[model samples]
Target: MILRCNTGGTRTDNFAFFIYAFSSLFAIVSPVGGVITFVSLTSDMSLDEKNYLASKSVILACIIALFFAVTGQIILNFFGVSIDSLRVAGGILLFVVAFDMILAKVSRESVTEKEIDISMERSDIWIFPIALPLLTGPGTITTIIVLMGSAVSVLQRGEVIAAILLTFLITGVLFHFSRRIYKFLGYTGMLVFTRLMGLLLAAMAVNFITIGIWNIYLSFQ
Candidate 1:
């Protein structure tokens, strides 16, 4: 009975971890944004070409996310930045992103109009704006780093990595079906969804800030 209880507790903790990781990454990545960008960029391409681009972009994003997850702590250490400081800074950045999302803006902080215009001139977009700023932008990178920093054990790190992989997989699938999703959601539905996600992200940003501040306080005491 004790063993069973312990196992159940572990399962619950893992579930909670996964949910937080998934939701935070999802809000930051904003697959709906990916759908819009993918559809527009691939409007002139064939279905096969669209599928190929989507796959490549998603795979690239997954690689980038994992790279950050592994190296984030090292990078922070090199920079002499504490995880709590990163959390505070990242929280501020995320809050700004959430504000843009709430306003139904395309998040110029992630992808600016100039970048999109330049991308239009390029033939291969899978590596450019699509994979970089579109799918795995600064916001997403910071979120992953923060989450990785918070991970206390190998198992927890693995769970965070798994969540990143799963989120990008879902993102790729959504991009592959971008046209269908756009038609189903329409512009208004998409705006509503973005706003709702923004609200959630804003709340998360507050939580991050609070935790960061509390940690900083504890360190001094």
Candidate 2:
């Protein structure tokens, strides 16, 4: 059996795959990176209201994510879509988002402050910006669909679910303490982290594009 070792200790391939799944989801979802925006938008809310919003947003995001992960392939097939084409398109979308993130520009996929302002008057703000684009935008959905499509085994699929749950659990906790996290990190620290995550995402995007292209080429041969 092939084995790998790190400072932590020796690990098997399964463990490595879990780590890959978790990290990929974490990088794309980026709950911590969105804390500042979350805090800013919720500044006028009471503590209880903030808590309610956080909980609801997480619940909605989790549901949406699970739905896409489970039904992603069926949706693709129904639409006559191929996983390779989705991957290439999704990778390009991710690259655009990452480029904006690296430059500290609010990604078009994400809600702008003005949009948030307009959305604030609505009761479904939690469903819209908080849960929709903020937590599971096009890029996030694309990643979910692509990853689920790539899974070949029940165990691997379980690992993906585990990763999704873990990522969102952390997301809820982070939003619960959004104020403190924002206070601790401040704007500059948050910017640094956002940029770092952007770099990671950009790398992932390139990997996705490369694999998609390679597979598509192989299919023709």
**Highest TM-score among the candidates is held by which one?**
1
For candidate 2, lDDT tens digit of each residue in 1-221? Answer: 65544323235655766787788888888898878778877998998999899999998998999999999999999999899999999999999888878987677877776887897677787898989998899988998889888776666677788989999999999999998888898999998998898999999899889999999999999
The best candidate in terms of lDDT: 1
Cα lDDT tens digits for candidate 1, 85-182: 98999899899999999998888767876777778778879988898988788889999999998876677788899999989989988998998999
Give the lDDT of residue 194 in candidate 2: 86
Clashes of each: 0, 0
lDDT: worst 10-residue window of model 2 = 2-11
The candidate 1 region of ten consecutive residues with least summed lDDT is: 1-10
Error of 2 at 219 (Å): 0.2
The whole-model lDDT of each prediction reads: 0.87, 0.86
Pairs with steric clashes in candidate 1: none
Q: In candidate 2, which residue pairs clash?
A: none
CA lDDT for candidate 1: 0.87
- Off by more than 4 A, model 1: 1-9
